[model samples]
Target: MRPFAFERAPDLAAAQRVVALSASSRAETVPAMLLAGGTTLLDLMKLDVLRPERVVDINALAGRFGGVAAEPAGLRLGALARMAQVADDAGVRRDYPVIAESLALAASAQLRNMASLGGNVLQRTRCSYFRDVSHAACNKRNPGSGCAALGGCNRQHAVLGTSDHCIATYPGDFAQALVALDAVVEIEGPQGARRLPFAGLHRLPGDRPDEETVLRPGEIIAGFLVPAGPWARRSRYVKVRDRESYAFAAASAAVALDLDGDRVREARIALGGVATIPWRAREAEAALAGQVLDEAGAERAAAAAFREARTHGDNDHKPELGRRTLVRALLEAARMEI
Candidate 1:
């Protein structure tokens, strides 16, 4: 890692000042990245993946942005809120089952406690080529360099929303669940505060595979507001992996459906492990609307989920795997009866 100066910001204003200073100092616009729990960021620094000239420590502002508050409309999860705190909170478990399940099914207990919700959402994908410093052609790590995963070892890469340049998968379990619940993120930047839908946060790798997020210069996510809806309670995050333990998803689905009598009233679906972004199955959702939850309906919904998937090479199996995962997720959510 390259040597750099480090400082702690006592409040949001001081943090903004630090960022502004970095931006104006002939560095990259929004030059300094905020330092949170150092779970993922520090590791990248050590790997020479991110060599920031200055690191702004936000630990002092931790208490201000790490609280969970429940409201009639929905829950507000602060950006600095620890994963363990949100996952184990009774309100999250009772009100947002998908969020709770996703967190509980993620990394080990230690990581969950150390990693914050915001950091987890913004975490990089686990693509091997993207992580390896040896892979000089990783487009995600360096723009216009090229993508080795295009025709390389890409069995674990994304199938949906892929491009000729990149095929890396989105690798967060909790974000998938949040996408299912239609969460919106609040961000503060030089342009002032703005709210962005969770779906809009990530971008598909078109030409600039390096730029992944919708965040502008110096924009930092403040918190997340998951809109409370009918399906928030009756939700489940089903992950199918190589193992049943703490492993990344081979195919995962987060489904939240509101059952009215024997028929589906509303459905919110987002998939992981098979897409470049949180895959929202709008067709599958439409297929299940006003339909009874039966074997046929489940299969139809699952099939519709992958209607437009553009799988190729070794990832051709993902469409089917994703279908089954969604079906299983819907079935699991139906059993919730909440």
Candidate 2:
């Protein structure tokens, strides 16, 4: 890792001040970064993909930030709460199966124990071009330089939210669940706290792939709030990866369905591993609403979900695979005992 100064933040305010003071004029570059799990941040730093001048440890504030509360109103998950803790919580497993399943299926037991919910959502792409300094052309790493994955080995790249500049897929399962459940993100910055829709947290790689999330400099993710809904209970997350363990998804779907007998009252679908961001398939949901929760309806919804998918040569099969994954997830969710 590169040489850097470190400090343990005693409180939220102290952490914010350190980052805010070191903030760069560019949104993509922050001189100081807050550390929670250090799962993603440390990895990037060692790879020389991220070179922060200072690292602020925020675990000292975990006493106030790490919490998992489930009430009739909704589910509130603190930013510092470990992935394993939230995934193993009885209320999360029972009431928000999709959320729990996503976390359970991610990384390994050790990573789950260390990774925090806030850091997980903000995790960067696993694109080889971006990670390796040898690859001289990675728009995500060095903006406007070029995108090596655009025509190179791009089977793992995105299809749903591709742009001329970049196609690196967002590689997190939890973000998809949050998007599907319409969770709200609580952000604490130097200005104070504010809430934003989870779906809006990530930005598409339109022309500037370097500018990923909508978070400002010195901003820290405080928590997540998922409202209680009938669809939340009857939800499932299906991930298809190259391997059974410690592998990233090739195509995955998070499905939440609210049904009335055999008919669908509502459907919420968020796609992962095939998009630049946690993709919410509103068109797919529209197709399934008021329709019978059957194979035919699922097929139609799946088609709608990938209608706008644009794939390069190596990843041409992603759209079809994504469609099948969604179909399978919807069918499996329909059969859930909940």
Candidate 3:
């Protein structure tokens, strides 16, 4: 809303140079956040949450920067790839079913068409305290001031990987599915282009809830690399909300199972709406390995995943919801053939 300069970038190199030249003097070099469809950024700016000095539009790089490729090696999704494109793509709906389902389950049709893959992955949590200017005590929005969610009405706060300083949940469905599949992100910056496993891309809030991702100041996400794995073909993303119509997940699970004659050969599980970040449930996978996929087995696995969950008052029901969501997701995934 405030006065800020805007420029449409011609290419990645030009975009990179524009960012470097504009932001080099700042302590952290990226002067302007690359603007895609501006769904998240613009929303924040309107709310006065984020007021970047400049806006760099990558509209011209659409064709050259966005596409989804299905290969023997894996799936490659360009950074500028639109959410609707990936969500509705036949390859995504057929092969990476969980990914498609997750995308379809988020926001709305218009926002999905406008939002980009990279922007969605980097979107911040939707904590109420962090959004309102009156509640500037939020540690995520303003560090060391105080945490409003600590004792405030926080039913949607995180249950896992939470510190006293912060407990805001990572509000993304697609990231959960991708992390479940062990997806990797390709990034380019001042140093050069490189790849990072999805698990390494996110960071725990720790004491500094201000910092979220591992991305440097001037870095840009290039693409997402999904390894051709057993779970990619047999996966399900299940979300549970209060009303179930364009609502954020109260508890969700992204589950992929490889079953062998009623026994689990392998499984990949990640939980959202219950963690500080996209939570990969290695414990749940371990519990399912070599075990059956019956109701009892699913319950056991779900319980294992939430075994270490430390929840607070008013939202203690999340652990139970997380367990039920996982159990249901596992059953749905087990039923899927190919």
**Could you estimate the TM-score for every candidate?**
0.94, 0.97, 0.95
Please write out the lDDT profile of model 1 over residues 1-338, one tens digit for every residue.
Answer: 77887878887877776656654433222357678877888878787777677788987876777799999999999999988999999999999989999988888788888998888888888888878889888777877788888778888889888898889999889999888899999988877899989988999989877777887656777999998888899999998898878688899999998998769999999999999888888899999999999878999999988888887677888999998888888888887857
Residues 40-112 of candidate 3 have per-residue lDDT tens digits of 9889878877767788898787786689999999899988999999999999899999999999999989999
Decoy 2 TM-score against native: 0.97
Stretches > 4 Å off in candidate 1: 17-31
Model 2 regions more than 4 Å off: 25-30
Candidate 2 per-residue C-alpha lDDT over 156-262 given as tens digits, one digit per residue, 9 for 90 to 100:
99999889999999999999999999999999987889999999999999999988888887788889999999999999999999999899999999999999998
Q: Whose TM-score is greatest here?
A: 2
Per-candidate clashes, comma-separated: 0, 0, 0
Give the alpha-carbon lDDT of every model: 0.85, 0.93, 0.87
Q: Candidate 2: lDDT over CA atoms? A: 0.93
**Ranked candidates, highest lDDT first:** 2, 3, 1
Q: Which is superior by TM-score, 2 or 3? A: 2
Q: In angstroms, how far off is 217's CA in candidate 1? A: 1.1
Off by over 4 Å in 3: 17-31
Error of 2 at 240 (Å): 0.3
